[model samples]
Target: MKKLENLQKQLGYEFKNIKILNEALTHKSTKMPYNNERLEFLGDAVMDLIVGEYLFKKFNKIAEGDMSKLRAALVNEKSFAMMAKELKIGEYINLSLAEENNGGREKISLLSDAYEAIMGAVYLEAGLEKVREIAINLLEICYPKIDLTNLVKDYKTALQEITQADFGVTPVYELTGSSGPDHKKEFEIALLLNGKEISRATGGSKKEAQQTAAKIALEKLKK
Candidate 1:
């Protein structure tokens, strides 16, 4: 009860219909009659438009393709999960005991979905304008210097360019290992240059691991 109040405070927007907020926080694993999936779908669409319009207005002279990439950069599981963490959404989630034991609260997909559902609930209850304000507030906070050049940061490509120039070889990614439940599997990947290991990282998926490893490798190259 009190925790939900704190969640609303964290969001900086109080919900007129608290039940809808609960529905948004309820996971399918709870076997509730009403879960957050539908709200997640709606929120996903809403966020797409919000981000699309933001990019459209922010970069008036940018091409359609570039705008799409920018939107893609922001509207992703990773980005949403980061925002979920910012709002501490995981703490308010209603998960099954099994899921809780499986670290559902920390799962990227779960957090991202909850974030979307919350936004969706907001949109449904208040309207697009209110939800847009909340979304923009979070985006600006999460990415304080949000801009075109830094949005779609392709660390893998940057590392490749650097390695190619110096070692005349591209960085290779090797899947080292994976574990955890199928719904929330963790993948470990090693970044290699000239058949030698440079950096290793673990993430929610292979692509995530690859990107994390690439980012780590890039940092190492920088120093």
Candidate 2:
């Protein structure tokens, strides 16, 4: 209860209905009668609507396909997980002993789902504008450069172009390691340039890990 109150302070939005807030932080792993599943469902819809509206109004001239791509890039597990990490949502979630032992606190999907439930709880209590204010602020802070070229840029392609121009060969991404359960595996990628490890990164998927490693390589190579 004290931690929940502190979470409110951290969120900067006090809840009139703390029950919803508690529900939002609850996971099904806890075997509770009322978990965050329903809240997560509501939050998922809320996130899409807010982001769709934001993109629509912000990028009036952009085509529908591009907007869809942008939304896809933003409204996903990886993105929300990162934001939830920032808010320390993982630390506050109610998980069972077995789930906790399995490192559910650090699980991206759990964090993502909890964050959605948080949004859902906020929206239910305070409406769209209030939740939008909170979500957009977090989005901008979490993703400082939120635009078409920035969000949709193919870092892997860009890295290849640079590598080819300089080394006359493209960089290679190799899976160095993987961890977590099968359903929530995190892939580790090593970006190799001319057979030397240039950078390494991890992500929810291989492609994501490769892209992230490529992005890191691009930055260092540029410098």
Find the 10 residues in a row with the least total lDDT in model 2: 1-10
- Judged by whole-model lDDT over C-alpha atoms, candidate 2 comes out at 0.93
Candidates' RMSD to native: 14.1, 13.9
lDDT of 1 by residue, 153-179 (tens): 568888899999998999999999999
Colliding pairs, model 1: none
* TM-scores of the candidates in the order shown: 0.71, 0.71
Candidates' C-alpha lDDT: 0.92, 0.93
Q: Tens digits of per-residue lDDT for model 2 on 83-166?
A: 898889988999999999999999999999999999999999999999999999999888888887678858999889888988
**Relative to the unseen true structure, what is the C-alpha lDDT of residue 25 in candidate 1, on a scale of 0 to 100?**
97
Candidate 2 ranges with C-alpha deviation above 4 Å? 155-223
